[model samples]
Target: MDNQSLNADILILEGLKVTPRSSIAAFIFLLLMYIFIMVANIGLVVLIFMERSLHQPMYLLFCNMSVNEVFGATIVVPHILRDLFVSDSERYIHYIVCVVQAFCVNLYGGVCHTILMTMTFDRYMAICNPLRYTIIMTNWMVVKLSVAAWAVVFVMVSILLSLTIRLSRCRRFIDNAHCDNASLFKLSCEDVVINHAFGLSYSVLLLGSSTGSVTLTYIKIATVCLRSKTKTINTKALQTCATHFTLYIILMFSAFIIIILHRFPHLSDHRKMVSTVGEVALPALNAVIYGLGVRYCIFWYRSDTK
Candidate 1:
């Protein structure tokens, strides 16, 4: 048989099978999480955009992050919940649907990372070059960076989706609850060296670059804060970067753990748990973490009115 025919046979042999699990509880949990993430992120974005007082570069970046979080969660969590609660027959996503989900998930994931790194740079410019901060982070600059991030992620995801759909599925039953790139790739009968190589290279490049940029930004901020002449200015600088730092640490560590777990087949369940936490839980918590500073900003604004 030709490669395509062989792959088709393998796919037919595997058939559709949903692993029996107590999906009801998982479904409820995921549903609540999706609601929470959507509400919190949407609320934050509205607050940042509507409040003229919050029209600074920092809050603008936060607004963008909030929007990205909403998109990210929408791409993955709803499907996971559906797969858990809905019947197996209803859970069978078409090939095109699966590819689209994977594409959007990866696209938003990449956008999140890039925006985070940009936020770090924004904080760095604010703290280290306060006088020139306005000039450096102009509206034009923000627009350009945002466009570039989305553009790159879109192109990358499109390529990945094309490669993924080209692969003949050897198995229809994905072990995971929802359609994930890694799970789908494992079911393919065709040689996946190119897909694997592209995935690994992109992960390393994006993750490493983002983490490094955030780390360096914080380090410089710290050094600058330590040597500052005024205690109040130093404190404010630190406070401003606090949210970004928290987000950076959480996302980078979670990503690192997920990647490590992914490399070991013996730890598949562990990887799933980690993936769940990283993808679903982390996005929800990020809205909270990043919003903490915003809350303080709002409080200060209110007090000033009094």
Candidate 2:
């Protein structure tokens, strides 16, 4: 058979396995969790947009991150919930749908990494170059950075997906609950050396640059805080950096865990359970972390003024 003939119109998803009784329970739990994720992230986004006082570069970046979290979670969680009720034999997703989901999943990760990288730059300017921060990270500049970040990620994801689409598929069954670029590409019958090489390079470049930026920026930030003899300066600077750094660490940690698990076939049985933390829990924690940070900042500001 020709490679095209072997390509499947409908791909089967060997989604999470659970008994009928547990399926309902899983559905309800996920439904509640999804609801909370939506409310928390959306609430933060709305609050930032509505409040004139919170229109600074830092909060604006937080808003971008929140929106991205919502986008990523919505793409995966709701679909999983729906599939929880689907019988194993009927749990099929169209080829087009799977491809689209894979694209969106890749897009979400790219956008997220880029945004965090931008945020690090913003924080570096604010902490390391306070006087010039207003000039460097203006509202107009934030808009530009945000737009540029999204545009770059879009281009990268498009390139990645295009490469995957060109490959001839030989399989129809995806051994996971959700669609991702790696899983989609694995179906190809032909050699995937190019695909794997490009993907590995893409991930390393994107993730490496982001991690490097965070490290250098934070190091500079720390040096600045230490050199300043003023206790209040040290306190405020550490507070701000702590918030951003915490989020950065959590995000990177979750991503690394997922990557590690995916690399090892032996972990396949436990992958779904662990992957849930990276996919769902991390986003929820992001909103909580930033929200608390905002609240603390407000309180600190009020006290200082008084």
Candidate 3:
């Protein structure tokens, strides 16, 4: 096939092979899942903004995290749901749409990790140095950090997409339901050593830094817990850090599992399902954790006011 011919207008998504009966079930389930994700995450953000008392640095960061969850899930779940109802032959996406989706999906991931890491740092400062927490984590500082996180992820995703877009695509079939950096670049007939090198370096740097930050923060928190003679400090630390840690673990575990699944081409469907579930479910789970934590705090806040 000639390069021009291979530059088709659409790319086939061969991952979501659903029977007529199964398609209906999957569509309903995903629709409900996406709805819940939107409500939970958006609801948290709205509540934080409405309540004046919840305008602390912690809640502000939670608001940012929830917004990020919404961003990530929106980039993926609707597309998957749409693909489910379509016939096998019609299960294709536009060439430009695919590239845009790939960019947004990867941007979601990079930003997600950055926000989570920022939240961890917030928790560390709040717990390890209560006296200086307010001084260090002012609203201005949170805004700066949030802006920096998005800016960093935006640049990284742009670089990765630029590399893929430069490649001469000689294929149009992606074996998964969604477009991503790996699947998009693999469609090219040209050598992709640079792509692979940059992708690996990107993942390693982001994941390693985020993981290392979480680890060190928790170790410091643990140290504080051990020497603290007061139950009040330990309880406060647990309340502040528990939800953030839960979210960190869930996101990292889902991400690592998907990465491992990609290594085995034979489990394309398994990989597809895992990837879809991760993208959809992780946001919902994050919102739920944050909602519960916020509820607990609100209970105390209300009690104090009463």
What are the per-model numbers of colliding residue pairs?
0, 0, 0
Sort by lDDT, best first. 3, 2, 1
On lDDT, the leading prediction is 3
RMSD in Å for candidate 3, one decimal? Answer: 1.9
| True-vs-predicted CA distance for residue 94, candidate 2, Å | 0.7
Screening candidate 3 with a backbone cut-off below 3 angstroms (N, C-alpha, C), the clashing residue pairs are: none
Q: Write the per-residue lDDT of candidate 1 for residues 113-151, one digit (tens) a residue.
A: 888888888888888998999998998898877787788
Q: In model 1, which range of ten residues has the least summed lDDT? A: 9-18
In angstroms, the error of model 3 at 11 is 1.3
Q: At residue 24, what lDDT does model 3 achieve?
A: 90
Task: Please give, for residues 120-184, the per-residue lDDT of candidate 2 as tens digits.
Answer: 89888887888998888988999999998899989988889889999978888887888888888
TM-score of each: 0.87, 0.95, 0.95
Query: Which stretches of candidate 2 lie above 4 Å from their native place?
Result: 1-7
| Deviating ranges (above 4 Å) for candidate 3 | 1-7
**Between candidates 1 and 3, the TM-score winner:** 3
TM-score of candidate 1 to 2 decimals: 0.87
